[model samples]
Target chain A: MARPVHSFVCEIGRVCSKAELKASEQPSALWVGVKAQKLPDLCLACLQAGGVFDSAFTYPSSISSHWAAVYVFCVPKLSKPVVLFSHAKQFHSVSAQIPAAVWDERKMREISGADFIGLNDLRPIIIHPESAKFVTNPLRGAHAPGRRPSARERSAGHEEPAGHGSEYGFAGTGEEGEFQIPVGPVHAGIIEPGHFRFHVGGEPIHKLEVRLSFLHRGIEDFACGRPMDGVLPLIEQVSADESVANGVAYAQAVESLASIEVPRKAESLRLILLELERIYSHLADLGGMAMDVGYYASSSRFATLRENMMRLNGRVGGSRFLRGLVVVGGMARDMPEDSLRQIRTSLRLFSDSLAKTEDLTLSSSTFIDRAFSTGRVSPEVARRLSLVGPVARASGVPCDARKHFAYGAYRSNAVRESLGQGGDVFSRFMVKLGEVKESVRLIEHQLAQDIDGPVLSERRDLSKLPSGRMALGWTEAPRGSCMFLVRSANKGALGRLAIRTASWRNWIGIQEAVRGNITADFPLINKSFNLSYAGADL
Target chain B: MHEFDALLSPKTDRIYADSPDPAIRELALFLKSRPLSPFSRSIAVRMVDCGSSNDVELEEGLTNAPQVDCERFGIHFVASPRHADVLIASGPVSVNMKLALEKTYRAMSRPKAVVAAGDGACTGGLLAGAHGVYKSGRVEEVIPVDVKVAGNPPAPYELVLGMLKAGQILSKKRI
Candidate 1:
């Protein structure tokens, strides 16, 4: 079924004159290659033509003369996504049209040494300012031709020379009574590090700036030159909580590039695991929201439910976090009938307890008072930022990939998208609660289907697999849309891998959401949109 | 109400008993014999994630779950390193965070002990030698680690056991 948006993209290509449209093997996505000079105009036309910016990334092409700047857009009524590419010798920028493109463009500039011409915020992203002198982009010399500049030459161009006191110059509101509060990079809780700067006048926050990438582990660089199978573990490590989603997205991308058809049973099992992940992840957020509100009773109850789910995951999948379960072609292991039975029984128990906890949490006046209207993000801000997953759903934007893209088992069984209109902490909390219930129903429905078949597809030798094929794989992770673009090179090694996690997209929304809220309410607001630093940084 | 009651009285004893596999049992016994055991049993731990997938952090959070309540064993998570007796570090030591890790470790008192949680912190796990990762990605390279809990993300029981073992090290050092 060709989506109407595909026709619109084709129309844009014809009008632009310098663009060539190519059909992607992956359903619901068309690739348009445009000339570098026409890219800005074409992208502006795309936005005018009703395309919402999804993500933008740059990767060195195997041809070596130029790097490819890929911009993904979600066109309304298009079943397939549209990706516009423009080749550049050195630099190009698109943040002038779409503000969300700034972060991705900055990252591309730093990692690939491409000059983004019109990017206003050019501060160093992935590489820390202090370490910029010592650490060069790992991918700098890998594919680029000619003698690469020495580390000194590369470091000289980047902003903020080493040891110039503060790593980032805090841009303040400059009000007379404005004071700054810096939190994290090393927080008091058991969480990953990312620094947050809040400019506050009394208790009200005037502006908030976030500095991340402390967990940049060179994952994309590490994937290069490694055998395809060897990289699944690394992809799964992108974010511990979203391992199943990331693994599935990476696997699907690889599978699509290789034209591998996974057995029906494997798809069903994947759906089950993905839903289980959603349940546990959302439960953690629910519990955290309660804890932040000082509702210990409901928080502990939610924690108990989450722990039960984790234990069930251990019994069913052999890992509490469901690691090493998903592979490129299919699942690494199959679920036995007895394990399925146990999961069903445990899920029923969990559902009943979760209902009680949800009731208790929503009924509490104090919990409601704290979470009701705090950290409100209007529908406009959410749409402008292109927020995804529960955060967007909470703001009443229907952006669920499962419903829109319908990959894997979702194609057979439709997913019910849970939405809330409040656009506040309470709305996000309700949306998560609603999503948890939906996931429980999805798991139950999936388990009832006939799921007897080979779990793992026949393994193809990595060296023999075709090379230089690019494919996009995406999944609706609990937080939002987790997408992966994989380019395979000779010998089954990855040429380029670009990831857009839900946290990466929704983090900017938090900066806008916390405005005007009191400093004391910051933790509550932050928890409502609980994003991952490692996932975003990577 | 009965279900709530049952949840409150979890099967923690059974889980705890099954947890002290030969390696942890030895550590438990060693902890009991330390001269400063009384003061050491109740220890405050500060966690610093150098560069983990946050899986280790999830496991660490579960230690506070009612099922694996480490507080009953006199172990608690403190906000500041200065007040902490044990430092629990998870994930591979990323190059950017190496200095912060060192500063955090130095901020702790002299009798402090470090427990490297997760395979990442213990031996750099899957991320070892990655370009952005520090040397070996292990906590021991930057600071002395008394106990290493090994798992992609060590289970909550394992984390509890590792922290206890670190508490024992603190006790031994104090003597």
Candidate 2:
């Protein structure tokens, strides 16, 4: 374990002053402290070491008054992720070089009021610029750092997002017949609220600007000062469809923070729950892709399969969305013998039905024609944005967190990182189809194992964990890989909780995918990626 | 050939049982027996997600799924509020989305009803008074709600039941 950390440190030594690099180790990751001036150089060095830019966020320092930024990178050959920390009040921006870091930096700017010196796009990512009336940047710890708000104090002096205006200056083409079309904050579908501005001349789109954050509810800020046990509900709300995945990720972070090992039975049950979520979530995307193309028959069949899947989930976990089952240390409660038996039978039926539906859908020539080349997110752009999950896989990027950053049951299961080369809607469809089969096979495999034991591990007093101890939890959610950065504060509370959902990374893919596609195919392309507005906003 | 075979096989029942859920069955039977009104027979709904984490929206979509199929009960979700008879808003209404919620409510013509679906909308759920949200985060705080269907997100059948009640209220308002 120390070998990889030493190698990473050795790599960092070549680029910057070794004296300024202070390295420390944790059970799961290596933490290094760097001067703010050295952030860009360290980030570049990490990237050169074959590290993928995982996530970056700003948190208030515990001992000092200064705000610090942590940039995390997942490097190959390292047993754990590498985290570099620096005080970020007026730090140099890495977004100028690493385009993937743009949104993270923009969010850091708004939340912590951190000034990134050389950053170009300084637009408000969460709080709308026109409605920036706040006593403080509501999320910043400067006002009442580490102090929990009482019931009555929750609303007073809090910033209310006010304006509903399309005021962001979208770069437009000055070509003849070019016109801009803005859609939503409230859209035409039953989907979540987001705005998409298109620069279209007639048939093809010149540029597409996606403005989200309409559903930003300050989930991360609200998690601060709350007890570790109390924060799971909020994490579950980050994206409802990915509840089990987010819960498991957060639980793993907390479990790792306290060094609690989960029992095997609990781990197997969690695997079942996570894969069930993937199957249902991917089903929605498949159905929506077909529905958008006017193929109602295939779409309805997919929806039926999804409904049956959800009903099975309801039977197993008592909630259609599979909530309240994955608690911090282990399973919230043991799955009954009957439920497991039911699950096995249901999965068999599900796979058989799924095979029929996949066969039926793929056999349709009209469906193929519509989905074939409609929304193409090239492999180059996918890499540039650091996209994850099926969207990345469809574009030939193969960045599944389950396979790359293996956690829980995935570590032993040896996931096949399903790949597609087309980088188009059909490729994404095929990728999701492949993943659904994989998830079913995985669940079946897990169920066949000896998984009978205590569901929950013995509860520990989490407040005993050292202050400022932080851990990273990553999960391959249905949409993609979502991450949780948990930093322990005094008295078991989280000082700062940063969430980066797959939708956050993949939302940019939609903007690129929509380019050159006709206005009518926009919905099809958007459905192909199926990025969650609330997940991205949160 | 595979498509035809799959289509021919009865995946879902041709007709649902009369009362799988007693509550939903009661509501469906009541709606069936109720006199014909503009909304009693059919209600056009526009769902606005104020800030509930997309769960309520998924349930709303599932209401259209073959198992729950709210379409059989004449519950049609529309694209525009102007064409809607009931405005279903899910919340803890975010501060950013409050104005849009208000605008959507105002767009619907009179003789309209509002259904606050999900615990978030009805009582602000977990994120009640958190930052980036208005006071209490309830739909009624911003707009009047005739029916409040509460759950973390009420299941599809529950939402359909709530809409059925909303249709009845819309009928009364029309009179």
Please name the candidate that would achieve the greatest lDDT relative to the true structure. Answer: 2
lDDT at B10 for candidate 1? 51
The lDDT values for all models are 0.82, 0.84
Q: In model 2, state the lDDT of residue A429.
A: 98
Docking tier of model 1: it is medium
lDDT per residue (tens digit) for residues B32-151 in model 1: 565656556599999999999988898889888887677877788988889988899986888788878888988898788899998999899898877778878899988988999898
TM-score of each candidate structure, all chains considered together: 0.94, 0.94
The Cα error of candidate 2 at residue A129, in Å, is: 3.3
Model 2 scores a C-alpha lDDT of 0.84
Where model 2 places Cα greater than 4 Å from the true spot, the runs are: A63-65, A133-166, B1-23
- Give the lDDT of residue A74 in candidate 2: 77
Query: Taking the tens digit of each residue's C-alpha lDDT, what string does model 1 give over A331-361?
Result: 8888899999987887787777777787888
Which residue pairs collide in model 2, if any? B92-B120
For candidate 1, please provide the TM-score of chain A on its own: 0.94
Summarize candidate 2's per-residue lDDT along B1-175 as a digit string, tens digits.
2221343243533332486655466665766577776677788999999998999999999989876678878899999999999999999888778878989998999899999999999998898757766778899999999999989989888898899889989978842
